[model samples]
Target chain A: SQTIHQWPATLVQPVGSPLSLECTVEGTSNPNLYWYRQAAGRGLQLLFYSVGIGQISSEVPQNLSASRPQDRQFILSSKKLLLSDSGFYLCAWSVKRGQPQHFGDGTRLSIL
Target chain B: AQSVTQLDSHISVSEGTPVLLRCNYSSSYSPSLFWYVQHPNKGLQLLLKYTSAATLVKGINGFEAEFKKSETSFHLTKPSAHMSDAAEYFCVVSPIYNDMRFGAGTRLTVKP
Candidate 1:
């Protein structure tokens, strides 16, 4: 069975602070990875997706960026955090494109 | 372009009553539809998915959804609501690979 792990299940940061969230999948290789943000009372917004290492497609223009360092390791980063950046961030992986994605527990980020 | 619409932003149902969460989608081609459930501050768990194979799909936790091509709708239903079923549900549409759209989500509130 495949499992996704996300670190820092909850985070609190001050404005202008750096942000880093990591996601890793076990038991699968060369899977599609995705980053999503869910604001309060809103649906999830896809921030970025990667098909392979060093290949990322951004869906929204924002302060956040994503990187795929390894076949199953993905990272979401920001040089500076904004108040609007506070939300629940999720990491998901799928065996192939157009397939059902499996998600991690998510990171709740609170910016002050 | 592909889009998904969840009919109700919030739905309240008494325990033991039937549950219905309506969803509509728009796609240029034959689309893949999915329903995901999220608990408070948790990751998304896929409830069901509809490919071209089955119009009626059964999912985990006694949940089921019907896909109607003529109506462009994929509506989720359950015979009896349970307290554990109270959560947010999202409808998703994928027209092609790497192109997935999510609905605003419908919050299901099950009352004891």
Candidate 2:
């Protein structure tokens, strides 16, 4: 059985502050990791995805950046956050291409 | 390029009635389709998937979806609706690769 863990289920950050969200998977190795953001009354938006460690792909360019430090560890970071950065951030993992993805509980970030 | 479109932005149905959420997809090749459910304030959960093997796929929580290649649609269906079933549903498509795309999502409301 595999499980994904995301830290800081809810976060409140001030404008221009830094942001870091962590995601780690257990019981699975070399899985594809993804980062998504969902705004209020909107759908999930892909931000980044990683097929392996140290290899990251940015889907939508913005202030956020993602890094895969380990085989099953992914982190989303930003040096300075913008007001539009506040949203529900989700971390997901998939076994291979065209497979179903497993998602974490997600982190609700509020920037004020 | 792969994309998905959910026909309805929001659907309201009475409890114990049949439920249907329409979805259409576009892809140059054979596409892999999926239905995902997200409860309020929770992570997205895989409901079902169609990988060209079976046109009708059954998923958890008594949900099912049928894939129509000619129509390029994958519509979710359930025999009966429950109050607990009220949530947001997303239609996803991937063209034999890991580049998964999600629709805007359709919010289901179960009325008593």
Predictions' DockQ, in order: 0.81, 0.82
What are the per-residue Cα lDDT tens digits for candidate 1 across A1-112? 9999998999999999999999999999899999999998999999999999999999999999999989999999999999999999999999888899999999999999
The CAPRI classification for model 1 reads as high
Give one digit per residue, the lDDT tens place, for model 2 in A47-101: 9999999999998989999999899999999999999999999999999767889
Sort candidate 2 into its docking category. Answer: high
Error of 2 at A38 (Å): 0.5
TM-score of decoy 1: 0.98
Clash pairs detected, candidate 2: none
Given candidate 2, what's the lDDT at residue A107?
A: 96
Model 2: residue A72 alpha-carbon error in angstroms: 0.6
Predicted structure 2, TM vs. truth: 0.98
Instruction: List candidate 2 segments past 4 Å from native.
Output: none
lDDT of 1 by residue, B1-112 (tens): 7899999999999999999999999988789999999999899999999999979999999999999999999999999999999999999998767557889999999999
DockQ of 2: 0.82
C-alpha TM-scores of all predictions: 0.98, 0.98
Tens digits of per-residue lDDT for model 2, B4-92: 99999999999999999999999888888999999977899999889889888999999999888899889999999999999999999
